[model samples]
Target: MSPSSRTPSGATEASDTPSEADETPALATIGEFGLIERVTRDRVQPPATLLGPGDDAAVVAQPDGRAVACVDVLVEGVHFRLDWSAPEDVGRKAVAANLADVAAMGAVPTGLLVGLAAPRDTPVETLEGLATGMWTEAEVVGVGLVGGDVASSPTLVVSVTALGSLEGRAPVTRDGARPGDVVAVCGRIGWAAAGLAVLTRGFRAPGVLVDAHRVPTPPYAAGPAAAHAGATAMIDVSDGLLADLGHVAADSGVRIELRRDAFAVPDRLAEVAPALGVDPIDWMLTGGEDHALAATFPAGTTLPAGFVEVGAVVEGEGVVVDGEPYAGAPGWEHFT
Candidate 1:
């Protein structure tokens, strides 16, 4: 079930109810450290963390003596809508998207730092709930919330920076995909896109797609697994499949030929496509935000479970879907 649906009965309605008079503003600029404690208290820390939220900086145990870091930013109206997604869902997505970048580097996430900007009138309870969501999702990836900053702003803007350890494995980059490599993917694809379509069409789905849009359940462990299994190149599918693959192709100077029939698109998506006046292939090829991992492995390599072979690398440039260059929308951009 989606987190919003799972919220206790009347909790949302109660939150939505207007008060006779706005409560007195708690305290302006509660100070960063004090606010951090308020948010991170009662949260669990990861086993690999040598130190957690406190001090000037967090200390994490990096067995490989190297750390992978990535950052993501979410804007209120552009990336998410407060009316549609709860604050908690926004928090979870902010952390998950950054963590996926770490995973794409073939590393296990170790810690995260969140930066939140909300209106002065934003409810303290809502901020706390958002923190809870961040902690919850970090726990799933075996990471800890190490620190953060909060400030007043006109609109909600969440930025997350994630740190990861390679566990002695070499970091995977986009330029390593050689010709004759097999391309594979781990985790669901296009669900978030389909959900976006449903939301745009003013329709409701079976909760799976909405949940996907809220919190992408990526195969976090599969990234390091692929590296150990000798993956040559890797990336996260935050941008549509073809657009992201194009990065690998451009970097490696090779062509990617995706076998569309190999994708495991959910039946719910197919069922809703006609009703929503959307095409399933559009979701499968050009949808983004699913945070799935896509990697290229040497031919004859045995792929780990939860990953499926979806394409292959060839001697050329750009990506082809089923032996032809797919001419669809490119992908997502911050400002277009």
Candidate 2:
């Protein structure tokens, strides 16, 4: 199930105790701390991090008194592939996806906790590349990889827990949208889906669409901006626009009507669609992973910078494009 298709639930946590072993031939020779030391080198610390790496646990400053947190897991061959993405790209993309969730809540990201489980034979250099990728993306927004853990497993799995502060603003969840609200979006969409399609087909053309698949650039600032502008509800376009918007509609109990004329397919996507034999607009509506922010504002309210109005919230449920229900493949689903 996708995050958008789930109901609220809670669970208890079990304490984790590390297993001890002697004389292991795996992990490319150096011990766990050695690997940690290698990756932790030269990493910049975020302002929100009170106590960074090497502590028993990290202490982050949440000035708002409320912390907005979300965790994401990326498994090799499931969420990412070594053949498809460079090690660094994988790390950067992992952080970007989770960071988008923070932004979706209309909060400013503060710190990140990365957890990596890889095959025992994994190279430390490969892991360092991944760390470099993580720090590169985190530094882009003036944050750091404050804390994380490295473990041995049969496959590579990257998990990230992002922390953000709302700065006293109310969180804009999918449930807050209401009738007569204006729908808007900030940042690029469909580029990642189009890029992935091109890559899967073995097209090596260098373009913005292609790069997007490797490293998604989420509109990090738009989250806080929307909150300051009084956005009613918001979500990140990790899944397709329609699918994510469906969450807002279902939760808010309002219909969202999207205007086709309000948006246009990017030239880069249109340029690649012919060779791939698929409509670029399909990617726009259904393709996700661009990490763009989708929000609903009250009618006649001035929108935040970078947000463009795309639709309106109405009395009903579900989403529509061009005055009718969208009959396309919904969005990214975890299981078939």
Candidate 3:
């Protein structure tokens, strides 16, 4: 469910530990170090890792002599709800978001660091599940969880920092777009937003939609591919298509004009939107968390595989859809 639709429970910390008969143990019983051991024990680290968890800090190698880093924070009730999402799902979402940031820079992820805060009474299983999810996603890019911190808090909080290597390639930035560049996007859009809408409305029969809200499949390889194919600028669609493109526009001092016909509403979203009395196109336009990569390439440049042309960079400012400013909200904002 969306953060706006729910409230935090403000639960009290648990004091008493469960007996041996209990199948699930509370964090209070395991203690901080024990919980860490449970999550990190026997896990394999990739070759990029110089050292794994157990030290005060981790050591990772960047062959290009430059390291790319980004951090993301997800808090209970604000970013996710346990009732609506499993701990594994939450874990994967947290890691995926940060990894996508690294990917957007045309870097290959090297390692991940996590910081977790939860009530003493929280179930150890929950944290373990989260760790599993994080590891699974990290494995997709052949990276590992090198180190992290855990603490006690009244509310649950997860913070992840992902590090990457550019591998001797020029890192693509949002400020490089120019007039006459073509805009393209790779990977899915609107599915997570549609999923959030479904969950917020209190119906969860469609597993695909709800599952999408729980996890995002980012085009990690596409970032590097776009860079190698002479992409001029790029950004991940964490907030929304128009909202994120606005950043590229502001930074590059150019206008982005998108064609509505360029986007085809996924049949799944098309079928679900009418039942919910909403437009599928709206979700594609403004929904966040899809983690799709949007980029600009010079005109006449051959686009990378999986990238579909959707717009063009022009001599102007801001973004326009079908030659007009979008009437709906451009994207997500934390405070407003």
The TM-score that candidate 1 achieves is: 0.88
lDDT per residue as tens, model 1, 1-336: 001212335333222333443464221334334446678777778777787766666787878788898889999899988777887888888888998899899998988987777765566666776888888888887788877666556677888999998888889999999999999999888899888777777765658898888788888889989999999999999988888988999999999999989886679888888887777877887889999999999999999787899999999888888998786665643212
lDDT of 2 at 30: 58
Clash number for model 1? 0
> What are the C-alpha RMSDs, in order, of all predicted structures?
7.6, 6.8, 5.5
lDDT of each prediction vs. the true structure?
Answer: 0.80, 0.83, 0.88
Candidate 2 per-residue lDDT, tens place, 64-176, comes to: 79999999999999888878788899999999999999999999889999888777666666787788898889988888788887766677899999999899989989899
lDDT of 1 at 67: 82
Ordering by lDDT = 3, 2, 1
TM-score of 2: 0.90
User: What digit string (tens of lDDT, one per residue) describes model 3 on residues 180-208?
Assistant: 99999998889999999999999894789
Error of 1 at 274 (Å): 1.1
Clashes of 2: 0
RMSD of 2: 6.8
Distance from true location, Cα of 285 in model 1, Å: 0.9
Q: Where in model 2 is the C-alpha error above 4 Å?
A: 1-26, 330-336
Point to the candidate with the largest TM-score.
Answer: 3
